[model samples]
Target chain A: MTVLVFLDPRHPEGRIADAAAPALLATDLGATRGDGVFESMLAVGGQPRKMGAHLDRLAASAHTLELDSPDRGAWERAVATALSEHLLRAGTGEAVVKLLLTRGAEGSDAPTAWVSVSPVPAGARERSSQGLAVVLLDRGYDSTLAERAPWLLLGAKTLSYAVNMAALRYAKANGADDAIFTSSDGKVLEGPTSTVILAVEEDGVKTLLTPELESGILPGTTQRALFDAAEAAGWALGYGPLEPVHLMEADAVWLVSSIRLLAPVTSIDGTPISSSPALTEELTALLHEAL
Target chain B: MTVLVFLDPRHPEGRIADAAAPALLATDLGATRGDGVFESMLAVGGQPRKMGAHLDRLAASAHTLELDSPDRGAWERAVATALSEHLLRAGTGEAVVKLLLTRGAEGSDAPTAWVSVSPVPAGARERSSQGLAVVLLDRGYDSTLAERAPWLLLGAKTLSYAVNMAALRYAKANGADDAIFTSSDGKVLEGPTSTVILAVEEDGVKTLLTPELESGILPGTTQRALFDAAEAAGWALGYGPLEPVHLMEADAVWLVSSIRLLAPVTSIDGTPISSSPALTEELTALLHEAL
Candidate 1:
């Protein structure tokens, strides 16, 4: 079951809406043109985790699209309302919370903003505990293109994710569980819905590495939190300029996201790689602590 | 005024819905992930023009996204119902008709499909008659990436058009009325919402040129129809590997779409370009005849 709350001017605490019923106009720009921004986060004990980071990213995405985002207080209240409703309806231990803001119905000036809470999917938990087989697909943009072409909205988490969904579909059809996109210039990038992270151990030191934000990838909030936690735990942190070779040579690799904390990547393009379950457990523990 | 018709299995003629009210579940993947395809066409005298081409493209787009599209007859009936209702309500001289299909509410296998008819926007007509100032923006993909990277969905007209819309917004913010995308490899591509077409006259021979479809651009229905009519009228045609230099050197350039028809580009990247009203008129007439 899912619970929804709309951030409306008429309701200070947000207006509760039925998630199973029709709640959006067919002509909403979010439905028609995908002119919107969204964020997904994990909730534990009826409280959303890393909401500050998610809301910051959502606001950044809206700014990139020149969309008028609601104030932080409104979103916070809506999220609270939705989570409480979900807890009442389903008594959830863990739930997935989503925040959505659209340009609204066609020709309307006001934007549409809503918050939704639902139980975490079984697949996300399974992927995190087991592992994922990932294929490296070309993302069709050079690593350096983001800074030059702002209109591409590379760093923004907008609703225009058909290509990302298609890439995942392509991976599944090609005998893989997920996909990690590589740039046209052959640099390693993020996964279709997660951040690519790899661990390298040298002598007695361990390091966590993720693709550079300048490479036209979304800034991974979970990755940032993990890196901070790992750093505090005496692990080195690095950003890339990484290639496919780096992933192969690393001691462990992970596709990390909010809901799927840290999922180990067992293979790349049908080739088995070194996957350290111990390292995954350690990093996941650190990540959870940070959250 | 607008009229909406939902293509439902229960409704043989399509179910009429109130466009002003909410009619879509917020969890619909089209609104959340933009996982859908759409087509828009102009209707004159209550009949949609070039509907066959639009429907064919819509099917191709859905196929690319692995979506299940409704039968052609269903879509036809919905469009007919929408157009008749629009005519009755507004008594329009011309109306814009849109066909939309979305992966339905999350976890449901069914798809949401609908037809909507509204009066043609005054801006579309104004752009065609008065021409437009267009800025060239980098689309961030290399010219040859489409075929090898099918997951990019370059040739499919999916509803994930936020980047396309952003490009147009970027142009407008920079004092231009529209935007023409150029591939990272320096090849001239189509406009954000229209096909790029240029006319050249050398040694008393008239020729029309557009970028090659292999450049990862959507197949332009209006461009194809216009080209067919121009060829029948003894005008030569060519496809490119076109560069920005070619556009600057052409005798005339225009952006063509179903609604706008033929909107001449008066400038590029803040520099004035050759725009011919006579050629726009001549080509528009041929296009209308074919439609």
Candidate 2:
């Protein structure tokens, strides 16, 4: 497995290879202490999707943990450089690029980084079509969401992904394809590894929504744009304490993210629904606009 | 600024440095995920106190995480080596040695292992004498504490010290020395950075109780032995829900750990306690028997 790396852009020292997967050293600071940050992006048609938004979120997450990050431009160039090299070879594959940054192998305060690419999840395409059956795991939301003051969540993504991954495993163990979390108080929150549930109201007058910045949910760049497009199209939008029951009653439920544009929900806790296809198509179109 | 690292007794390459710090890089399979286990012990008078017990607890934690540890003989040698080196230096300065083992840091599935030591907090002596104040913070009781059926938490001491440090910072900013986290239901749980609260009963019984393991509290090794000693000495021992009112009504409170045997809690959330010399003396004796 070839992994490339860069620090403040530049090769982050001679250790970074052009396109080879370099062996990464995970130190106490990185693995044992979970002192780091990570970002996963979908590389579509040889280009990094939503690069700026991802970088912005990364910076914010880094700031949250007092972790360091490569400067924006340099990091950007480094990524672009790698992507270009792969493209120059005329090789293309739907890829998942992960940027992982930690406090370093010595357990010191200095930031360590690694970049690696893997084949996009084999099930992703199929999952998008079949959609996800999700349960409320109650881990991710309970960790830090309840205390966040909306709007501030646009921060960089830190490395405390144990809970996130656990949520996914929990869902699988519980007979569900995936999991979503709600606030401890029970307002529908986000997927175990994705964004919130959104759908259009039955009457088609408004695009009922999940709370934005105020929800303390990670600001999904793709989801945010979709909502904006809804408004531009004159579809009224809302954000609130969405009871899980409400999403089921709505015309449609779409799980939005960077890779999968929208994964429709067939049921909520096993309750099936008959939502309007027109609404999903309309919202997805808006998602592109928002992007 | 010199740091000392003790290679795992299983030091993969059979390489162990005699001075300070290990030579190999930490691998990150589980450490990156905070998926490992660790134990901190106190080294005093050229000997590590309660070493067997600490090692026992560490083994239990590893079992909880399902991680493999080096053989006991290797562990003893590593500890013996590190302690002998420190003993030769002979300074009044206290030290903290942290042993971390996660999935390998080379990004291999086999966990990584690393250990290091640093000067202990300079004020430990002062705080032990004058006692320290505590602020109550809310780091909700982990939901899986009961059933003890693999809460990763049983093994997760590897990487999430950030939360512990953050709780400490919260206490400092709130005009207290450290933070004690209570359950969401207002039950007194352990501190975000330490274990249970202790107090002498008005009836003069030297009780050293702790919240039940089911109350989403980590089983504090120090507190466990104290309970046995308290009972052996004719003092009643109890455990279960720790309501805030119960904590506030006590005669004296103390926080126990591997490093700080029993730091008296003079005040909580800014409220002072009536110092109990009997409770202090008895608790100290119990701690001395074990640590």
Candidate 3:
């Protein structure tokens, strides 16, 4: 079951809508041209986590697209409404909360904004506990292209994710569970819906490394939280111009996201790699505490 | 006024729906993930033009996305029903007919397919009659990447068009009317929503040219029709690994699409270039005859 709430001027708390019923016009640019922005985060015990960061990213995405966004208060209220509705309907333990904003229907000036809450999928939980395999695919953009071409909207989490979805499908069809995109210049990038993180232990120094933000990947909110927590806990942090070699040589690698907190990657291209269960447990604990 | 017709298994003639009301679920992946394909064509007196080409391309796009497409007959019936409904409501002069197919709501296996017919926007007609200025933008992908990275879905017209829309918005914000995308490797690509066509007349030999399909541009149905008619009229045809210099050197340049038809490019990147009213007229006539 899913609970939905729309941010409306007429309703201060948000207008609850039936998720199973039709609630969007056919001509909405979100459905037609994919002119929109979205963010998804996890909710525990009917309370949303890291919502401020998600809202900030969503606003940045809207700004990149030149889309008008609702005020933060409206979004907060809508999220609250959706979460309460979810708790009432399903007594949520762990729920996935999503915020969506579109350019609205054709010829209309008003934008469409909504919040949705649903139960966490079983696959995500299973993947987080049991390590999975991933394939590296070319993202078709050089690492430096993002700075030169702002119209590409590379860092924005827009609704135009068909290529990302295709890459994931390609990985699964090729005998992998997920994909990690590599730049045309051969720099390591993020996964379809997650951030690529690697742990390097050299000379007794444990460090967490992620691809640099300049590489045109979305800024991962969960990664940020995890990095902050890890740093406070005496773990070093680094950013890169990372390559696949780094993953191959790392002490452990993970694909991290809000819903799937930390999913350890067991192999790449059918070749088994080193994975440390103790490190996974430690990071997961830090991440949960940070959230 | 807009008229909508949905392709339903129980309704062989298609089911008519109110376009102004909510007709799509908010959870539909087309709105959420932009995981879908679409086609738009112009209809004259309730008859859609170049429908066969559009349908073929739609099927190809769905295949690339691994989406299940409704049978061609179902789409045909839906389009006919929409056009007829549009005629009844608006007394058709020229209507824009769109075919949309989405990977249904959330976890549902069924796809959502529909046809919509609406009157042509006045801006499109104005742009076609009075040539518009265009800006050259980088598409962030090299011309050769498409062939190597099929998962990028470069050749498919998917619903994930946020970048395309952003490019157009950027052009307008920069004092241009439209945008023409160029590959990162400096090869001339197509426009955000149209195909680039150029005419060269050297030593009294008239020729038509378009960028090669290998450059990962969407094959223009209007361009194909015009080229066929021009060839029958003894005009030579050529394909290119074209550069912006080629466009500057051509006698005439145009951005053509199904709805806007043949819109001549008056200038590129704020620089006034060569344009021919005579050529535009002649080609428009040929294209109409072919259609």
Candidate 4:
């Protein structure tokens, strides 16, 4: 597929007219190398959901990679342009767009950024309704002091996604739709294919749980929005060192991401459970309003 | 680049025709998904030096990735065929070949395996004669434990080469030919572009040090061969948490790899250092005998 990208977000067209692939251009280093950072956003209609928060988190991710904050205005304009272009051409209200930041050739400090659009991947919606069957594997990451663990591309959506793909492959081979990663110590970690697994309690407490900061999972963008909604809706919200047994007994299970607002999970290890619609319903309403 | 490969080390082609590439009838998994392990060997003349050791390491790497290994006998024949084919066409002793192993599709594993050969990359010899300059960076990788890190496709020559290419780009942009990696704490690690470094202590202890098992650096085949040879030649070997300062002050430096035996370090971080012939002589002899 021919991808349209901004080699220099500062002057994106210069690259397009010159026919320079973002991956091939000198400044567009981080995107292809998975060097810099990235944020995947869900678009309902023409506007991106939670644009500001995603940008905020992207800044933190860049700092982790020791890169400068790419100009927010430039990024803002690029997204607006890409989305508007999408609307003008395809006219699809449902979309998923990705913003990728790469280290530039202007030395290690040069900031480079790009944005692209694509249709939502297949199976995300059905899985959201039916829930994903998952396997929990220990990714063996130490996420302690995660903010200061600059030696990792951890929180940042870097391009080095071989491990991530491998994790998904492992899940499929194990007869699961996706995987939930855990630590070596049997502590429940995030899913290999998604963010923290969320489950509600019988007392009407909406809990937002995933691996703690020490679990080496990429902090979730959509997960935070739901946590806020859970609180506003008068449900108790909390984070925990959730074990697999705890997840098995929860009121509902969902894999949160920008594209799939909350993909509720119905089974784990082939064990089926009842699905909770109220939690996913409230989460989506709050997310739409937040957007 | 059509080349021959041994299907199994023993068959040598009268048996398994799959040699490097599996039969087309076999389930196709590796090509699209990149789900397998591979090793690149530097074969000179008609023989692959350390071929047995290379195959052994390939199996070890496969085990780490949870992929099935090919029979030693079958693998050897496939490799021999690959070498013979390259020699038949190129008529050159100088060559580089790759061996690949993937889980076969017979069962639940992602299966496929094959081999490919190409001429040695150009300018390799010239670059070795006149050392390349280097810049250092953090791979978001702790150089410690990298040698055996679980998440690391480190020692395994997996399909993921994006980071390796980025390392080279980082070095070239810094006005150097390569980049050295370090721990997040600024402890010098391995070269982003190559293996850990080496030098001779003026006190006569032959030293070729890299980061420890915890440093997350891949153990180079050339480094291993050199160490064994150094030991046989009555020189002691050591590894290190080599700091940038320690390297700048070293009497000599060189990068080791199977294809490029020993490339000298002409300068580091912009400071010029005179090349040492004595160090190069010992390393060349060591690699030559091993290959």
Candidates 1 and 4: which is better by lDDT? 1
Ranking by lDDT: 3, 1, 4, 2
Instruction: Give the better candidate number (3 or 4) by lDDT.
Output: 3
lDDT of 3: 0.94
lDDT of 3 by residue, B1-291 (tens): 889899999999999999999999999999999999999999999999999999999999999899999999999999988888888899968999999999999999999999999999877667566988999999988999889999999989999999999999999999999999999899999999999999999999999999999999998989999999999999999999999999988999999999888899989998899999999999999999999
Question: Candidate 4 on B187-224: residue-level lDDT in tens?
Answer: 87666545755675767566666656456566677677
Q: How many residue pairs in model 3 have overlapping backbones?
A: 0
Cα lDDT tens digits for candidate 1, A92-171? 68999999999999999999999989999977678556988999999988999999999999999999999999999999
**Which ten-residue region of model 2 chain A has the weakest summed lDDT?**
A148-157
Per-model TM values vs. the true structure: 0.99, 0.81, 0.99, 0.62
Give the better candidate number (2 or 3) by TM-score: 3
Candidate 4 segments exceeding 4 Å error: A1-3, A7-23, A26-33, A105-112, A143-148, A202-204, B1-154, B157-219, B227-281, B288-291
Query: Which digits, one per residue and each the tens of the lDDT, describe model 2 over residues A80-132?
Result: 65566555554677666667677776535567766655556667756764766
Candidate 3 chain A: minimum summed lDDT over ten consecutive residues — where? Answer: A121-130
Q: Which should have the higher lDDT, number 1 or number 3?
A: 3
Per candidate, native contacts kept equal 0.94, 0.28, 0.93, 0.05
Tell me the spans in candidate 3 whose CA falls farther than 4 Å from its real position: none
**What do the candidate models score in CA lDDT, each in turn?**
0.93, 0.62, 0.94, 0.63
List DockQ for all candidates.
0.93, 0.29, 0.93, 0.09
Worst 10 residues of 1 chain B by lDDT: B122-131
